[model samples]
Target: MAIDPKYLMESYANPIDYWELFSKSGLSKFPPCVVSVAITGGNQGKESNPNLPETLDEQVQQTYDAYKEGASLVHIHCRCPHDPSTVTDDPEVYRELNRRIRKKCPDIIINNTVIGGKWSRNGVMCPPMNVSIPARPEVGSVDITNYTWSMMRKGRPEYGRPQDTLEEMQYTINKQELEHTLSEMKKYGVKPEFELFDIGDLQYLRDLIQEGKTDPNVPNWVQMVFTPALTYQTPDMLLAAIRHMPKNTVLGIVATGGCQYPFLALALILGCNVRVGMEDGYYVEKGVLAESNAQLVAKIVRIAKELGRPIATPAQAREILGLGAPRMEF
Candidate 1:
């Protein structure tokens, strides 16, 4: 049969019919992209924003309000009730906060933090503590056969440490710490949102999965947090990091300070989810501090809508993110 020029022109001019047909036949439903509101980070002080929730009661109330406003997920970092400057690694605190939020908004996904504040050389907030141990016999054996192995398995096996002489190894939270945190979250049916500050963090997550530390059915959501002072927090850099992310992993962008909104905008445009709040950036605009976490989320929602993107609701987000039953009844 001879190809018709007129037919070719028609196909080119109106591809919508073909696209819709293809979409219906092959594409799974595109879950509405979720917008997570990070109510409070562990680092920021009350001086930064009086509206920032510091105490457990304040954190719970703020998280509940955000969920009511339209946040499907609340990214949380528990601060010491007595000291905002200190980051608590206590699973008890996380459990309490998680319980409170679940009671308030049953369907809202609670994302707990694994990476605490950056510890200083004197064990303060600057250089994070280093935790390294020899890979288990199985991990080492698997490295020999696994095609995906990338770390130096033979060298002085350092797990989570900055490669610097001046870097002092502070208190290292081991597998016990991880188990404790995971156990608490499991109690409330809350999902952990891992924060990968560097490639090492990504490797650690893979290890967790391999060691059966994390459940496969549980949706593995990760945030690629970029620190401009420590690492390049640019669009290209963020994209490069995403390229290496594991499959079935949902990613959110979290760039500190000036690069925060810009990276978030990039994430939204790229059809990925995002996290924004006082934890990532204090300012809603240049030189203007955000009054609340809701304000930040509202701003992102506005931008997403303007770009013709729909914000994911709690149920829709759960489906998209592959979460199990909601922790509490809605």
Candidate 2:
């Protein structure tokens, strides 16, 4: 049998044309929209806000409530009950929490955090192991710095007050730890949302992809965080970081304090996603407290709708994140 000339020549044509054709044919619409709820972060204890849940039970309840409100995905950071201030890297902690969350709300997608804890020596860091692949190009690099106020005590205790010292401390991730954490993440089958604090982190991800640890077809969501104390996370910063992102990846913005609205709006406008919760910002607006994760999700839903963008359902979001459809058993 003779092969068709058009089909043979098509292989040499631009990939962009193929993508345009696929998009025009409506194959793109099948992937539902995504709404990720950042449930409980590692930082911000009960002292910061009594509403923040510390234990697994409380975290599960909070996640269930957010799902009810409209969150299809939940970003989780497991905490140690013995020390509310610390973040635990133990897989059991994450598995237990995942189990509870699955039992309560099986349909919601669960995203686990590889970035954990505030180390006096290392500050804030990435997963212990570096996991990246050639096709994906963004999974194995460590571009973020871990810094905390606790480091200030090293020098002049008097000059290094609680707020001042915590704001200035910083640390970097080593290769061994990065590999270990990525291995654990894969073992759990929990999707990871790479948290990038600066443009350097983006470069690290790119290197990881080149090294062959990340999967290109999978939706690797990268979050750009702007904290209140240190540097400002501007719109330009987001654009710069994502300028070189691979086709299968998605970008999200997380503002630590009052900049959530600005960055959230920017993310949506830039054709990216947005994450909001007590973990990112406590205030719904200036001087107003967000009562729950649902309240924050509602606000994002309203914003997306007003901008003519639709909010994604849990099932749809699962497909986008490359997760299996909600299993009642899980």
Candidate 3:
């Protein structure tokens, strides 16, 4: 069957209504796929994967390597220099990190985390909100939903730490934090990446758009992070997420742990973008540890290539996400 060029372009523009046309179209009709790599997560560090970058220098190098391997967008979490175990919310730390990163990967989209880092401000644990200042990252993640993150590592000898362990932490971003985060993003011209965990979060975003709290003009970057703790990694869940997404959404899928590879591949087939890195999963494959973030990125790049999906460069990603030119400079 021959596909019309105008119709295919329209399908890319009107993604919500054109899902059938885009997904059913041949390889020639596939839109450029943006590959985002979350270099390091706030929860686990060298303990989970020895290669996980913790210091400022390590992160910059890892990011540059990933960018070379076809990842156009980089999601970052700055670890407190003083306490490497905990994530930092210090604006100065984020500023310095973003500066160093820009020096290395100039055009790659720098996305700082609002919910990844857990630090104490008055002896009370809190997520970072000052990530946009000074750094003014091109993108910053805003977690819309709250849930308990429960995980257990049992007899995983491949990892550096193989001890059987269980962790259950209540993750949240309160109303005040949300207001401040949104205000800061608007102030700095940073694109908001909505971190969603379930179907309800999509509704919450919809309500925000209707309330005029969120800018409806800008395309919504909805990143659905699928984990068994909050939402299962399954086709039904992914499809439901796509079905509930609001109009003008650039959907990105992330599955925690071992499901990352398969989940992202499925996302590619459905004409959605994908995220990969140690933050999401440490292993490149089952029982095979990933040496660096670039390795994970290369794996996905190969998958997208095999599926006939062209990888989006940083410049292309900016256009796809409806972002302006590089805002922050060193």
Candidate 4:
């Protein structure tokens, strides 16, 4: 369906739809928007995007650049020191990564993923949901539920080894593991960024809170992270999820493919923060791939500014997330 000249001319009437949404939603008065750059995903490496960092030095340097480009916090997923593409669940790996990143850019708030990695082993795809970091990250992710993706890793070199013709993959967020992971985070003073892919994940979290396992007094980083298997991907779906979410929390939106860019503005309009990078999306434009994580971050900063929302500093982000001071020096 080609958008002809006539259609284009008609579009000018409401050319900037985001403005209309913001004005109608009364989201003009927005909190400082925090931009979190996921430097690397536990499942992907240089194969997906050569610019994706594979070494500790690369990750730290890339993250430092992203910090300079207005990124307040960084979401980290470590790659193997030996292979640079493999994901490891070892606590030492997490500790070393945290230490190196801290030594380089001490001011950027650091977040660690609970997921170590997922790969096919012995003809079975193991979900790396069972993990605990000894490094004691300032914040960690807590994912809920799992979905089956038919096209998970078929001929998708980006998903895994291109040579392996993989089948259906079940990326489950093991409840038992999640409970343990959350307990560890609490033990180490790490706040969890509860990541919900479906609406049901909310009730699961509430149950945990009621059990006195979690503290509602602290502002939870409630993340509405989307997957390809998600039944709902529309803005209205997000709105509905937001309604069900606990009021005492900070909202963030993360989407894959090319949807990350649109969500950046939509989140701001709804008074939500944003997660952007090669992990969430690889493209800065329709065909242009981002050269670095900072490039993707800089793009969102511009969009937030255009909407009259200022970017939050590291200190502001810490306040928004109810986090302590920066753990290291820059």
- Per-candidate TM equals 0.68, 0.74, 0.87, 0.84
Candidate 1 local lDDT, 1-330, one digit each (tens): 222221111221233643553356321222345888777764444556678887888888878766766678877667765555555656566667777778788778766554422333344444221110110000000000111111111111132232322333232345566666555545544455666666556677777777876667644667666775445777777666665665546666677777677677776655467777777777889988877778888888777776666788988776666665665432
Number of the top TM-score candidate = 3
Worst 10 residues of 3 by lDDT: 1-10
Cα lDDT, model 3, residue 14: 46
> RMSD to native for every prediction?
12.2, 8.0, 5.1, 8.9
- The candidates, ranked best first by lDDT, are 3, 4, 2, 1
What Cα-based lDDT does every candidate model obtain?
0.58, 0.60, 0.78, 0.71
Q: At residue 158, give the lDDT of candidate 2.
A: 28
Which prediction has more favorable TM-score, 2 or 3?
A: 3
Let me know the TM-score candidate 4 reaches against the reference structure: 0.84
Off by over 4 Å in 2: 1-33, 89-91, 116-118, 121-169, 228-231, 327-330
Which structure is stronger by lDDT: 1 or 4?
4
Which segments of candidate 4 are over 4 A away from where they belong?
1-28, 116-132, 151-167
lDDT (Cα, tens digit) per residue for candidate 4, span 1-330: 111221111211232543554565444455677899998876555655778877878888889899999998888877667556566667677778788878777777888887522434334775353354567788887666665565433243544466644455556556676677777777877888887878887788778777776775666677788755674567877777666775455778887765667866876766678888777776788888679999999999999888887789988788877777877622
lDDT of 2 by residue, 1-330 (tens): 222221221221334644564455432321223667777775565555667777888889889988887787777777766665556656567667777888888777766655522233344443322222211211222334554433222122222224423334444455555655566556645455667766666677777677766655565666666665544678666656556564456556677666778778766655566788787776788987778888888888788766666677876565555566554443
Candidate 3: tens digits of C-alpha lDDT, residues 1-330: 222232122344445646655556644467688899999987777766889899998999999999999999999888889766667768888889888888888888999886533433234565555554547888888887877665654443443336866756666666677777788788877778889988888888887777777776567787899987789899888877777777667788898866778888888877788999988988988988889999999999999998787899998788778776775556
| Range of the 10 consecutive residues with the lowest summed lDDT in candidate 2 | 130-139
